[model samples]
Target: MMASVYDIWGAGFETTVATLQFAIIYLLNYPEVQRKLHEEMDGVIGREQELTMDDQKRLPYLCATIQEVQRASNVAPINFVRTTTEDIVVAGYLLRKGMNVIPQMPSLHLDDKLFPDPERFDPKRHLDKQGNFVKSDYVMPFSLGKRACMGESLARMELFLFLGTMVQKCEFQSVDKDAPPKIAVTP
Candidate 1:
């Protein structure tokens, strides 16, 4: 039982941390996005009390921002390769039963066809014209199907609560005013 707990925490909690770091990076890069986040947090999860998952409904922009962070962050760039249990045809390609299926989840998140202008870190993409959070089916940050990340819901909840609460009280800014914040690429 303890091992299971440790394993889940190591995998799940670490990814949440990564997502939060990415959120901070993006927030620093885009002050306008940070300002909007502050506005939403102020309106919904004010300084009076701590934010809970229940407040998520009232914070559509916060939710959309988190979704955008997850989409752009691409924490788990590649998913655990799963083998086909039986012969299957996907995208007009047939795969043998025992063939290993390597799913590159980032492909979906960064796909221009699914998400228009996939390069931009605009949370508005996750929101509808009416300003409501329109959860996109293509936002497969946690991936899709049976072998998807087990801690997806937990990660989302933690991101929303922790990021929401942090952004509510504090204002983040970049050190250099003139130059944009740089995102380092690493394996």
Candidate 2:
């Protein structure tokens, strides 16, 4: 019981922190994106209002920015290993039953075909023409399916609340005003 609790706590803490760091880095690198986030948050959430999960649906740009951060950051690049219950063929490769398989999440998240200019941090990719947030199956920062991260819901709520409140309260900028450091996504 203690082990399970520790795993949940540690996993949630580490991944969320890493993602938050990437978000700050991206915001500093893309002032325009940060500006748009601020605009949307101010318009929908307002300065005096406390952010909530319900507010997440109303903040399209903020949602898109968070989605984009998860995609671009590739915080959890590889999913946990799974064993095939039965023989199957994937992409023409035959696999016997009980075979161990791991899903490479970064490939899907950063695929040029799925996300054009994948290297660039653009939240518009997750936005529709009408400016609504569009969720993508390919952006699986917490993995997917039945075996997906157990702490997904908690982590998401934490991220939305934490990030939303932070942006609403603070303005982030690079220390070196003239030149910001280039953004890099490492696996």
Candidate 3:
């Protein structure tokens, strides 16, 4: 009944690394966010104490920034397939029973109504006017509903801890100083 240990770690590690690489690249481009994170770390954990999992909730902006990273990463563009239990009409087309439905996770992200300036990377959008993490109905890196990633909660916790620990301890400078901006290519 259990997935192989290799498969579990493989799925978890590869996606986690890719997400972190994107986060590092974004933080490099936005130094202010990095600076703010550093300040928050210093304020909460102080220069002497090592950060712990307990520190995750105390770091509000850091959490928001991480969520934004997950949001903007767009790693899993297309969602998993599911069969409809009953007939339904969608966009003037009839979907019969047992028909396969694959929602576009990336397309929902690109919707301007949900994410303004869909091209720009902004973490503030994840936070409400009161500077708290406002829940978004969108953001489906692991897809959504019943077929959503089984490791969703574990992934979120690990990401927050990893990012908070790394940024708090060391500095990262991009080696590709003159690399051209990447162009979007849909598959």
How many residue pairs clash in each candidate at the backbone level?
0, 0, 0
lDDT string, candidate 3, 44-139, tens digits? 887668777688667878887887777777777777798988999988999999999997877877778889987677778887787777657787
Residue range 43-87, candidate 1, lDDT tens digits:
766787788888888889999999998888888888788889999
- Local distance difference test, candidate 3: 0.78
lDDT of 2 by residue, 1-187 (tens): 9999999999999999999989999999999999998999888889989998999889988889999999999898877998888999998999999999998888888899999999899999999999999998889998877899999999989989999999999999899978886777775
Indicate the residue-level lDDT of 156 in model 3: 82
- Tell me how many residue pairs clash in candidate 1: 0
Which segments of candidate 2 are over 4 A away from where they belong?
A: none
TM-score (all chains, Cα) for each model = 0.94, 0.96, 0.86
Which residue runs does candidate 1 get wrong by more than 4 Å? 185-187
lDDT top scorer: 2
Q: Is candidate 1 or candidate 2 better by lDDT?
A: 2
